[model samples]
Target: MIGGILVLAAMLLTGTLTFWQQVERALADNAYTFANSYLDMAVTLAGVLMVLRGLVYVLRMQRELRNFKDDTWSCLELLIHGLRDDVRSIRRHLPIMLGGLLLLGLLSRLQLILGGVGFNDGWAELILVGIGVLMVYAFFRYRLQVHVRPRLEALEAVRRELAGDSLKPDDL
Candidate 1:
């Protein structure tokens, strides 16, 4: 917060000097030029810092993606082994939902072709359908990750260790 205040102060000071050049000799003629140059340098430096911050953000996101990949794979293995029932439940529901959506798509197309629906040919209808499908998929993913999958994986891990066929350190 202090750094932000300093940056704001520097910017405001520069702006005031630039706009009110006649109020002070330090902001007149070559003195003004020098001060203005310094302000430009400060602004450029700030921009460079922002770019560096963006690079750091990207680096952190990349690291997170790698970690998520490892975790997701481990969880998937556990789900397959220990939570067959839950996985089967998801698999059963997902296909039916997908099929229903697909049927709606066909119906929409047919309506457009036959002039049976007002929105049959419009891009808006198609976009709405696309968004709806995406929302459904997102919900499914959330449920799999947070609701049914974690417990299943934990149980599977415990079962494996009990059977003396435990996972390697790298697997965990």
Candidate 2:
């Protein structure tokens, strides 16, 4: 869902910028040209940063999952299995999401680079950027909810199991 939102934002931003550039070219306005370029640069930079951040998060999650299996707790053992499965799911989907975002960012950057497009500030742009921000937030939530929490639960379960306590599914 977050991936879908990011892709949508990328598409909207790219289209808006391209159309705005065409309109600017038609008018041949010299005003605010530098500001427009900077804005475009900022958006591109933000998107790239998001991709890098996501990659880092995925790497960190993988490392944690690796450590999880080595823990001695019986509950952790169960958790390790579930976490492994979760990590696998994340690994499968994350690269595709990153690739799509990267492609969108690249295409947007290309438009700015080759077309010398002018970007004016508008409410629509703000909304789209906000959506992009929300998508990032959603991704973070997914990582925590799907990956981190499960691993932590597994570890806790292992601890309980080692302590000779039975675990409920809710305990997990």
Q: Candidate 2, residues 51-115: lDDT per residue as tens digits?
A: 55555455555565676556466435555655555565456555566455445544554555565
lDDT of 1 by residue, 63-135 (tens): 5445545665564453454346546645685556555554555554554556544443344554565676678
Task: Please list the residue runs of candidate 1 whose C-alpha ends up more than 4 Å from where it truly belongs after superposition.
Answer: 1-82, 115-123, 164-172
- What's the C-alpha lDDT at position 53 in model 2? 50
The prediction achieving the highest lDDT against the true structure is: 2
Give the TM-score comparing model 1 with the true structure, all chains together: 0.37
lDDT of 2 at 76: 56
Mind sharing the TM-score for model 2?
0.37
Q: In order, what is each prediction's RMSD in angstroms?
A: 20.4, 12.7
Models 1 onward score TM values of 0.37, 0.37
What's the lDDT for residue 23 in model 2? 51
Task: List the lowest-lDDT window of 10 residues for candidate 2.
Answer: 32-41
| lDDT against true structure, model 2 | 0.56
